[model samples]
Target chain A: MSEPFRFHTRLNLVELLGRRAGTVRELLTGIREVPGASIYHHTHRFLQQHHFLSPEPPNDFAYWISGSLGLNDIGERLASIDTVRYRRINDLRTRYVEILEEALAARRNSWPVCQESDEFHFMSCRTFIIPLPAVARDAGEFLDILGRISVNSLYYHVFESRLWLERGENDFAVWFEARGDHELAGALARLDPYTITLEGLRQEIIGLVRRHVQDR
Target chain B: MSRIDDYVPVAGASEVEELRLLAARLEGKTIRNVNSTAVGGGVAEILTRMLPLLKELGVDARWDVIKGNERFFAVTKNMHNALHGMDVPVTGDDLDFFVDVNRRNAAEMDLASDILFIHDPQPIALVERKGDLGGKWIWRCHIDFTDPRPEIWAFLKGYIERYDGAVFSAPAFSRPLSVRQVLISPSIDPLSDKNRDLGEDEIDRVCAGYGIDRGRPIVTQISRFDYLKDPVGVIKAYRMVKEHMDCQLVLAGGGATDDPEGLRVLDEVKREAEGDPDVLVLFLPPASDIEINALQRASSVVLQKSLKEGFGLTVAEALWKAKPVIASAVGGIPLQIAHKYSGILTRTVEGAAFWIKQLLQEPEYARKLGVNGREHIRANYLITRHIRDYLLLFLSLYFEKDVIRL
Candidate 1:
């Protein structure tokens, strides 16, 4: 057997950059100038914080643009960015910037501004990834530990590692493919993680892995 | 005194274990929390409950109360009001006295620890001893900084910048400072007396003791008799709701003895509710957590009509009990409510009255809101999450990078 898959989880602490924007123009500047950490924080904050209730929650930019600035058209476009398709934070950020630039061009004369209290405060987070006690030596052991691990551990493996960390594939799929399970690895890779809740994703993965383990 | 293990069921078992892991990183460090008043305010209450859990997690946590005279408190009180944008008169001498009091407390107390966490404006000046103490200092501001008085903010800014970092209850409270600023929202202990689950018998007995009838739908606002809480606006909203249906309003809280303005506001509320029999005005004594819990549980709709607020933990408390809440979108109240998802957020007295009437008329919708609200509080506003954030914050100070692998 290959090396064991070490399960790791992260604890994130959010910090306010003390920069705020009331208009789309200012938001564009912030999206361009702020570090990638700030961009990651805004896009993925709700997923980490509200893992239990997930109806494909919108990013902070979409939420503020629609709810506060009354720009549902551009907000919807931003929300439909297909986060799973982007393999890196810079790519996701570039897409957001492009959307805002188009919005700016279309509404050059009629730009709306949010109230002073309603401005979007830019924030970033620091994360500490620590090893959990759980490790899986084989597919059966991986399936067993997947059901009981914290949602945070699952999130780090599936979402954070796949997209923002630019790993090209989720850790589980990578592990499976390395173990010569091409069919199961492809199946896990095809799943769209953004559309489902964290727990829902866990169940789906468990079902797929269970079928493979039983067939073996 | 509920132990850390007692919160395992409330906050999931996995989360409790996760907190232990986060605390393990800071196993040998000592964290000293300095605040004013061992009783009464939110900071003290949180420290009282949190110190033991932190210690149980193997972090040597201790709390120290800064000493101050009544005159010093008065000056600091004015400073506090001024920081909230109120035009309170505070002279230069008063500022000097505030610093002098902190200097005296610094001399008397043991200022040695790996982390010195100073809470609020009273002990803010204690940062002056950082050179002698030689440790990381963090100032946790628990107030709204939307529009602070310039003179008072200028005075505090000098001291605030001297610290290694600052913590604000909400993003709105953060000021543009040179030091690092983190956003850490305040939390409610679910196992605490004010938030613990009460039996139907205890709830009914407490309501009966307060002369409340369980037959009518009850609307409650649990806050002190302060103008910022907008107790009078609450009565106005309740009267508007009363015009539509048969409902009762409960305004219950204490701690009005020290503030003369609180006494005046209490009297004004009485006059406004003089002829209304359904309006029950309760000025409960301190340590009335069980009564407050019962009042919230018995309430059909909970309200927090604050014109200005810090974080409005009452909203979280009511939501934790799965009760529908209507609160103003000021300060951190917006952080708790998602506007008709978990709970309702209002901007005016009419908006509040409309939601109150709508929720009472529609039972199923109200139930859904309450259920969603409980889940929201379970995920975000519990003390377990707060402790996790603090542990991460303590660890963040030692690492300069955004992502760390340990």
Candidate 2:
């Protein structure tokens, strides 16, 4: 008999949050300590203010685990993870490191630093920072993270898979490889950092306004 | 009766009017004109300006373009190259395609006029439809057909025999065809944007925009981006002249939509002029008439170094501006420019460079040549004279005259 086809679900927010729990915890705490800290404080306040202890049933395994541990308690659980699972994660990380090394080597040898301003800068490290208002901090962080992670990872995954053997795939491969260059990726990485700081500052102002509202 | 004032004449307006009056004697006759294109070429440009003038003279003059799709055009383009003495393959399929397109155009077009004029090879097959609509058909060839490919000529001769007469631009371009052939050179409209006088400010502005120094000696040629124009040869001549005389060359022209080989030829030209700072290779758009006029006016000497020319209008345009021209003594150029009198004629790059250096050295001689050239154009190659010739030719079909006394 023919083997049955296996359909795998894509990795979601639950998997990503669980995998990088320590980093997320450290980022969240650093944001909350600063009042009037721009977008950073607002981002932490939004994460901490969510009703994790609500009586509603958790949607999935990652949500249930997250709720049990609480948002502030993720760093300790990540540290206490079993050795076998940690080893597997390390192996995946090493594979990613090798792919990046190969790309860097290719870039160093072949690519020229694009000098013509008239032509589109396809592989440049230029970043544009947009100032976000204090009130729309959580919404801003959500959008900023969504834009950077989804687009950049999608670009990197396409190049790493080498899906360029098909007839029409060359154009797509060129576009993704251009976007996933080190300079372009570095520019995109700074977007999340600036977004997080702006979000934090927005929340502190909102809290002060709320206290004024209650007293009145 | 239609008056001559209704028509816009470029030159020799009075003589044209006199001829039109003579043509009015034969009032009821119909006159027809056949040519390759109704746009982009000199034949089309002349016919567009001349047809109305003829109609206003009480002679019925109509113009027609030969119909051809991309494949037919490609074959005809090869035929064009072959007729210029290039050894190109004119396959049976190419002839078949040419005949098929002509037959199709003949079916759709009305060929019932009294005097039918067939322009070039593209519409030469329309003479096959002459049995049903009998008239005096004239084959007006605007190209050098002295050494056409034998196979292609044999095929075209079957249609050429049907014509009552043939017209050639130059005596050299003529071959011993069965029909009676006449020589009538092409002319230019002095009032047209490419030849008309521009204000000093407008000329200055255009020169500034293109980074052309108005004070420096500018040598220019304005023709379509075709191999026959020999833009690369113009650069060679310019470089040779630059050895002694400090001058800049402007190779300014546009490509027509009908010519498929234009882009490839332009790319080859750009490759040849890789690092030449003094050479300005401008690929002007079709609508750049004023800019062309400005360049010609600003030029110290105008050159048309065509390897093979049907009729280089740039010679007439420069002459109309009273600028001394150094043109190749090929095709219709000799008809316009009389060597050392009206303009200097040359055959090779060395000859052209020699004349350019001479003209730069002696301003008085160059100025006198320019003066003689303007009067020559005024006497022979103006649109007025061209319109008068057609009017007279149309009238002659009905009435036989020993000499046309316009």
Candidate 3:
């Protein structure tokens, strides 16, 4: 129903190491804002096993980041230090987070400003990934924003999200109700995702969103 | 239970009667289904099974396949991938050829019926006849449209909007269309040759013919030899599993009549599978249902490693046989497998390999998943339920003005 979330920073570890932070410690300090544990473990295991065979550079966090985030290109050419030098798990974590940011950054530029579709399925290869700075004022603005783009764009942003699906519809529905959109929340609860057509449901939702948008 | 009466044992008499009552209500309406291919793929298969049953239930139903040449089919194939968001480059020539082919077919074929049902984009343009012709045209999009390429979708959207209604396999498969849209997930017939019960000897015989030893832990993917199915990815995952356990891989499938790229993809798969004696690449002939049924029953684990899929029937087929299925969590696959409950949904080759190895290592857990999987299929995926849903859809269209006094 959806794709992985877009990470914030775009620090290409390979390029960063090659240019700004050659040592793992400096790279760790640079990417400290991004937590390491969230995405590093799986990338670490993949690197531990397939890093040598993969085109992703071994010494830098770029390989782990690129591979983990499904990015097609190997990360930047920032020369990397030996992983043996940093024995602590936090060192690995920071590298992973840094590499993730690098890939995410690359993915953002990979497509058109208003993307028609996703290619490479890397960091920015998601459906409803609009970085909402704040919640919508009402249903109208929300629907207007959602409808401004293609239907696919509207889908991932609110309804068919992986995070929402994983947490179950009730939690999402409750959140919707709390946002003062009870009419939309009730409609969501009534429809079965498997059997309902988004066409019919979206019409109703857009109608409601438009109603609110005009109200303001 | 191969007959309509036979379904009573599994679906229960009352449930079958409900379908019967719905069919009875739809009795006078003539339902005509039009598609691109008649022999290969799921839409054809489902129609083949359902049309006759619909006729038996007293609703006049017919199936027709549109006419197209080699170039037209090739374009449609590309269109199929593009619709599924495969990033394939589809040009103006492709779109023109597709429309030209559909125009010719529309001129030739009699698309007349009370309800004219069009399946997928292959024959979607046929819906353009709705204005000249009089009928409730239902555009049944069986392929995944979750992330369709913008240009291709824009081209198809014109004809699609003309339909009285649309049917998607899942809500995610839907887009913002003006037509009334409903979700009707495709289903497999429990009493069909491809899904019916088979003896142990029959299972052994099918495995023996393919040189697949049934004793070993077998991970099989039953699908068309298309790139979208990712036979190469399945091999990669199989190799990963082989590194851990002494398992065998079976990539068994045949090409559809409509897909010209099948042979080239088959060659690519063979090249990818070269030098691996454990890998069994079987090109089964069409209608080899007994062989297909036997393979699913014989395998310890069934895999559907599709890069993009439109409700992989093979996944449902294997689950109906109560085999532990590990499939890509794309399209309608996740809707079938509940992840660690009925079956497992994997994202990558490594992830698929991990689950295959886990299932092979723990027979008890695999068996448990299979048991749960059978129940899930029984409740959700069998043909009887599909018939009921379709009948209801047809009746709903006809009875929209009424409050259901039937």
Which candidate should be chosen as best, given lDDT against the real structure? 1
What would the per-residue lDDT of candidate 1 be over residues A1-216, giving only the tens digit for each residue?
A: 678999998778899998999999999999999989899999998777666666745888998898789899999998888988888999999999999998888835688999787889999988788899999999889988999988888999998788767799999999999989999999999999887889999999999999999898
List the pairs of residues colliding in candidate 1. Answer: none
lDDT of 3 by residue, B188-229 (tens): 888888988999999988889888887788889999898889
All candidates' TM-scores? Answer: 0.96, 0.60, 0.61
Candidate 1 residue lDDT tens string, B288-378: 9999999999999999999888888999999999999999888898888877778898879999999999999998999988998998899
lDDT of 2 by residue, B205-270 (tens): 998999998788999988878887888888888888888978888888888666678877788788
**Residues A1-216, candidate 2, lDDT per residue (tens digit)?**
222211111111000010111222332332232222121111122222111111211111112123223332332332222211211323323332343334334423332222111111001011111111212122233233323221212222221112111122222223322434333223332222112322332343234334433554
Q: What is the lDDT of candidate 2?
A: 0.58
What are the candidates' C-alpha RMSDs? 1.7, 35.1, 16.8
Q: For candidate 2, what's the RMSD?
A: 35.1
Model 2 off-target regions past 4 Å? A1-216, B1-13, B35-37, B64-70, B256-276, B399-401, B404-406
TM-score of chain A of 3: 0.31
Of 1 and 2, the candidate ranking higher by TM-score:
1
Q: Output the TM-score of candidate 1.
A: 0.96
- Comparing 2 and 3 by TM-score, which wins? 3
Model 2 TM-score, 2 decimals: 0.60
CAPRI quality band, candidate 1:
medium
Judge candidate 3 at residue A68 and give its lDDT: 29
